[model samples]
Target: MKVINTKIADVKIIEPSVFGDERGFFMETWNQKNFELLVSGKPTLFVQDNHSKSKKGILRGLHYQTKSTQGKLVRVIVGEVFDVAIDMREKSATFGQWVGVYLSANNKRQLWVPEGFAHGFYVTSDEAEFVYKCTDFYDPDSEISILWDDPSINIKWPLIGDPILSKKDENAIYLSDAPKLSL
Candidate 1:
């Protein structure tokens, strides 16, 4: 696997080594030892795995849990999407800043969003299947959503029209008003 650093040091873009032949292709998606070496250099356990599918124009986040605070390793499995991560750690140098990347089944790239960051994505294809491994269990009551188009963060979403947002996301508060991670 190869790791590429994003503007926010805690976030990373991972490219796994793919081996292909006339038949098809194979890539080791995860290996605890290898992943640990790349990140914290300590045991990192993914306690949960999640998968979601969305149609084009669907925008699903800028969300994080104030309590469970998950660190995620996410990727696209069926189509393409522009994934984003915002640093919500109050004391970090890159606090309130964000990074965006195009993740597609064709590219097979994955992104690492550490704890204390808000994550979201915009579908760029007809449809997309997104999946991720999270270090913590979901805590719906603790989940906080920040406005996808919050002016303070000013995320440059690659959109052709207004995105289709869930009611929760539509009503999300701006970064200035949202609760941030104290870490």
Candidate 2:
């Protein structure tokens, strides 16, 4: 596995070694020891795994949990997406800043969104199957959604038209008014 640093110190792009032949291909998606080294040099335990499918133009986040804040390792398994992570840690140098990465089945890249950041993605293909491992359990009541197009964070979403947002996301507040996480 290879780890690439994003502008925010805590975000990372991971490329796993893939071995292929005439038949097909094989790659280890996760190994506790290796992942720990890539993150914080401590045990990084993922307590939950999630999978979601979305059609093109579907934008699903800028979400974080104020209580059970989750650190996620996400990837695209079927199509492609422009994944984003925003640093919400109040004391960090990159607070309120964001980074976007293109993740696709062909590239097989995974992004590490550390705790204290809001994450979301935009589908860039006809459809996409997204998967992720999370460090904490989901706490719906504690989840907070920030506006996908919040000007303060100014995310450059690659869009063909206005994004299709969920009702929660459509009503999300901007970073300036949203609750922040402290490091």
Candidate 3:
């Protein structure tokens, strides 16, 4: 696997090694030991796996859990998406800053979003399939959403008309007013 660092400190873009032949190709998606070595600082441990599919122009989140240690390792399995991870750690140097990555089946890139970051994605293809690993189980009560287009952290999304969003995301609060995570 090849680990690519983004502008953000802990955020990363990982590309798996693919071996192709006349028939097809094969690549290992995950190996606990290999993943651990690539991630900086403390070792990561995932407890839950999630998969979702969305149509073009669909935006999912700028969401995270405030009361739980929930880090995510996310990737796109089919189609393409403009994935984003925003730094919400109140005490960090990059607080409120966001980074965007282009993930697609052809590229096979994964984003490792550590605890204290809010994550979301925009489907740039006709349809998209996404999968992710979480360090903790879902906590509805603790889940918090920051408006995707919050002015305070204006994300330069490569938009294609208005994105379809869930009610929760549509009603999400601005980052300035949302509860801060003391990471």
Candidate 4:
């Protein structure tokens, strides 16, 4: 596996080694020891797994938890998506900065979004099956949604049309007005 750094210090793009033939291809999506060796700093432990399917133009997230924040390792299983992560840690140098990655079944790239970041993705293909492992359990009361297009964060989404958002996402607060995360 290869770990690539993103503009944000702790965010990473992980490329796994793949073996292919005329018929198909295979790669190990996650291995605790391998990840620890490839990524810098402290080790990560994923406790919960979640998956979602979205059609083209659908957008979800820009979400983070105030307590028991989650660090996610996300990848696309069926189609393509433009995944983004924003650094929300107030004391960090890259706070408010964001990075985007293209993830698809064909490319087999995974994004590592640590705690103190809000994550969201736009489906670029007809349909996308996305899955992720989280370090922490979900906490409804601790959830916070930062608006996807907050001027302060200024995420440049790939899709042109109005994105389909959940009621929670559509009503998300701007970064300036949102609660900050502590790393």
Candidate 5:
């Protein structure tokens, strides 16, 4: 796998090696050693895996958990999406800044969002399937969603009008009022 770094410090776009034959194709989705070689500091242990499906124009987040419990590797499987990561690390130079990338089945690109960022995505195709691995299990109480359209951060969502959102996301805190990270 080849890792591509983004302008933001901890985000990356990973391209996996795919071998295709007459019948089909194959690729290793996740290999511990290869991942370690590309990413300098990440826990080898990932406790939970999650997947979700969304239709075009659906926006899922600007979300993150509290520190020590923050980090996820996400990718698109069946369709295309504009994946995003926003730095929330209080001490980082890019704090409150965001980055976006297009991920799809054809590209087979993966996104690595480190512990101090809020991550989200917007489905750009008729339908999209997304999957991700988290170093820590889901903790609803600990999960926090910063408003996807928070003017303070001003995410340039590639949408015409209002994008579909979950009730929880619609009620997410705006960046100005978001819980600050102590670490």
Candidate 6:
């Protein structure tokens, strides 16, 4: 696997080595040893897994946890998505900065979003099946959401029109009112 650095320090993109033959293909999606070797100092301990499906133009986040803060390893199991991560760590040089990655079943690329960041994604294909492993469990009380179009950190979304959002997401606070994290 190859680890690629993003504009944000805590966010990384990992490309796995695929071995394809006449039948299909195979790749080691996650290996504890390889992860430790490739991503230096990374504590690859995931205790929870989550999956979601979205139609094209649907956006699910700009979401993060405050108490049970989750560090996610995200990847698309089927279809494609435009995944993004925003650095919310107040002391970081790239605070409020963001990075995006195009992840798909075809590419087999994974994005590692450590704690102290907000994560989101838009379905770029007709439909996308997204799955991720989190270092922490889902704690609704600790979860926070940032408005997807907050002016302070205007994210260039690949939306055709108004992307579908949950009621909670539609009511998310803007960055100006959102809480900051200390890494």
Could you tell which candidate, 4 or 5, scores higher by lDDT?
A: 4
Query: What local lDDT does model 6 show for residue 170?
Result: 97
**Angstrom error at residue 93, model 3:** 0.1
TM-score of 6: 0.96
For all predicted structures, in order, the TM-scores are 0.98, 0.98, 0.97, 0.97, 0.94, 0.96
Q: Considering every candidate listed, which one attains the maximal lDDT?
A: 1
lDDT of 2 by residue, 135-160 (tens): 99999999999999888888999999
Q: Deviation in angstroms for 49 in model 6?
A: 0.8
The C-alpha local distance difference test score for the whole of candidate 4 amounts to: 0.92
Candidate 5 TM-score, true structure as reference: 0.94
| TM-score (C-alpha) between model 2 and the true structure | 0.98
Residue-level lDDT tens digits of model 3 in 33-68: 888887745777889999999999999998999887
Candidate 5 off by > 4 Å:
none
Give the distance in Å from residue 127's predicted Cα in candidate 5 to where it truly belongs. 0.8
lDDT of 5 by residue, 20-134 (tens): 9999889889988778678746546778899999999899997888845657888888999999999887888888999999999989999988777889999989999999998
Worst-scoring 10-residue span by lDDT in model 3: 36-45
Candidate 6 weakest lDDT stretch, 10 residues: 35-44
TM-score of decoy 1: 0.98
Ten residues in sequence with the least summed lDDT for candidate 2 = 36-45
Please report how far candidate 5 places residue 75 from its true position, in Å. Answer: 0.9
